[model samples]
Target: MNSKKLKILLSLFTLNSLSLYLYFSSHPDHRRLPSRSYSVSEYSPPHHPLSVKPWPILPSYLPWSQNSEPPFRSCEAYFGNGFTRRVDPLKPNAESHRKISPSAGGGGWFRCFYSETLRSSICEGGRIRMVPERIEMSRGGEKLESVIGREEDDELPNFRDGAFEIEVGDRSRVGKKLVDEEFLDKYLEEGTIDRHTMRGLIGSIRSVDATEFVCSEWIEEPTLLVTRFEYANLFHTVTDWYSTYVASRVTGLPIRPHVVFVDGHCQTPLEETWTALFSSLTYAKNFSSPVCFRHAILVPLGYETPLFKGLSETIDCYGASAQELWQKPDNKKTARLSEFGEMIRAAFGFPVDRHHIPKPASGHNILFVRREDYLAHPRHGGKVQTRLSNEPEVFDSIKSWASNHPNCKLNVVNGLFAHMPMKEQIRAIQDAAVIVGAHGAGLTHIVSATPKTVILEIISIEYRRPHFELIARWKGLEYHAIHLRGSYADPPVVIDKLSAILRNLGC
Candidate 1:
């Protein structure tokens, strides 16, 4: 009786336990419990400030403005001379924010602002200058407010340390050796310059990041970095100068640069005059008065060479010769080129007035740039084998065509202007409506020409280069090209084509 009773009770208990387990596994409410618990963690939004102070609208000259949707708020957050990493509220998670170097190379005033709706932030990428007893920001010739009350931890390194500056020797004959001897001799004597040698020259001294120049020299003010690398040849000097502009674009900082020179003749009359017009030329060895920069940027050389890995095109470019560095081309982008021109006109001790160009009394000046007596290469002088020939006929035909139009003003400017002061050169080209010239470095003066000007480039078929063509396109000028055939000294230009070009320009 005891065995039968125990077996029946055990079997009944086991059956009930199995039935309960099966019911819970298939039940809809019981199945959803696990997923609901997981969703609580995944779908919960991170906490962020619902409201922010209205973002102050920056002036146009200040580089940026509040162009997004409303609820835009920005505040000035202070950082130590060398601060990196995102500020508070910009990104709730400190790790997710971008690593920013406020004192790019040295220490100065820095600002960070954000748009809550856009979930993005913008900061001063360059050095900011402060007035005595006042917190002010100086940029693009305008003064801005440096509001306080929001300060972040200064996570920057000791900017005064020599870690940023790269020195070879006191005089560092690298510049001289490259420009005067090795660069020229190797290219001229050897007929073909080595690529590694050229790349070494670019990376050796001249190519440094803008942040590398930030130091205690400037103390606590903003600095503009001016580089004096290759300023002899007009093409090399101007193209090199494009790096400074590119640095500013990359860092959002003003370019207050210190010019380092290897050659006594580092800059030509035009180069010197061009720089003097906006920023002063200075030597890096002037330690007693070392150029101080709060916000500094280095324009990496963008070339078709290996020393700089980026391509010449603006799009599809990145990486640098050095780590943590960015690279961009010195070629023309319309807005940047126009800004460069305006800054140049302002620097030359002239009023920044665009109206200085006199209205056309009759018609625009058809300034014909003749290369009759001009020579680029040292061996170019005694050559009957030059690329441009029949210069006299080209000038004569343009003059003859101009006579037919009452508004057409014809001026034949020979190479004599090369000897003129840079100011005179700027003045001569500044008022020109139509710049007609042979393909040469003299055409670089088009940087001073007003917008909507016409540029007619007479290129020799033997030596065809798109340098000036790119310049004209960037400067927003009307460009027309005429090819020549025959000898360099007397290549023939199509007179009828020249006449048609003049007619289209309302000559």
Candidate 2:
């Protein structure tokens, strides 16, 4: 019972502890659990690892040197009349092709072509460039005097009506001496001739010639030129993103094209949700420093671009039409809308190829997209128009209903998208079995929802638009609409509609 016995006991205890440590180290799975344990939430799914492929990097060489490269051709030879094949004008889906011949001295020429099926226009080849600020047209290495040369008089082209200079004394002018009034006006006009129109005009009028421009960087791969809307609304932004995807598919690009935003207007930078869809993103102004691409495709905005037209009577559904272009007969994997959604999810490191998965055993998430007042941009006053006057009441009703549901687990998620990160918003949408929201831009997240997810849009009579319905149709998701007689939807009515929808899903 003295020092000798204590030493013997300590030796036995130390040997046992060392043996256990060594055993646990060799087989770590046998380690004892910590006092605190974490539980997986029924509604919060695990995030998928980032699986985006690296973007392709093309070689950049000195201007004239790259002309010998595979895709690079002399401007004169490329835009020659004989270079392009003539299509029958009478054909149903005939493409409209306009050829601009080189001026007398031989500077640069371009061909503006429009596809009827895609409803998009693209111009190729030219020497003289007519940008918004500068208008330079060269013929035989000589700068042209006028847009159309006349033998009698040699004077610069006049653009008095279209162009205006900002007066120095004008109060609107903070410090700038000169401002392009034409560009400013066009930019301010929301639906009219915007930066996209100007880009198209410049691309058509401008010429890429061997005589004047030595391509600084000759991009060999086909590039997608996207002109985004100045205001970054989710609905319009989705259209632009979809157009880029469709352009890549139609053009037969082996891989997704590197997206280049051609518009100089910088109202907002690309949102994080959309940035991942592109292999790479760049600005057209980035190329004005004098870069040339072997092939550049300008994707049209939204419905005009291709694939799907929103609420257009002439063509209600173009998703199927676009599917024909890329979906191979043997390939059972990709559907047009589903593939686009997957691409976005993959970019954000979300689970892909889950379109056909069964509902979770734990529960079904009912995501209620809550619209809140926040300044979307600098011009915004942080006051959003009320689509649902009783949004809070409606949300509370849904939450209460979910908590009381008897048949199956129903988890209610308040999707405050504006306050959450884009990836988190996407995760919420992916987790949801049903998404409910008033007729608002927030409902645009339906484009990213899982295939099995259902959409319940409560449209006030004042806001009875087919925006979400059309999107649901295109995405092949089940859609339900509660046409309210006024701005306020009765919570009881909304709950009833939701109950019916859930009952149909066997919930």
Q: Pick the candidate with the highest lDDT.
A: 2
- TM-score per model over all chains: 0.50, 0.62
Q: Model 1: residues >4 Å from true position, as ranges? A: 1-230, 249-267, 285-296, 302-333, 349-359, 372-385, 400-409, 413-415, 488-494
Every candidate's lDDT: 0.39, 0.51
RMSD of 2: 22.3
**Candidate 1 Cα deviation (angstroms), residue 361:** 1.0
* Candidate 1 CA-lDDT value: 0.39
Q: How would you encode candidate 1's per-residue C-alpha lDDT over 212-304 as one tens digit per residue? A: 332333332222333332343565656555444433332332223333321112223555564563234443333332233333333323231
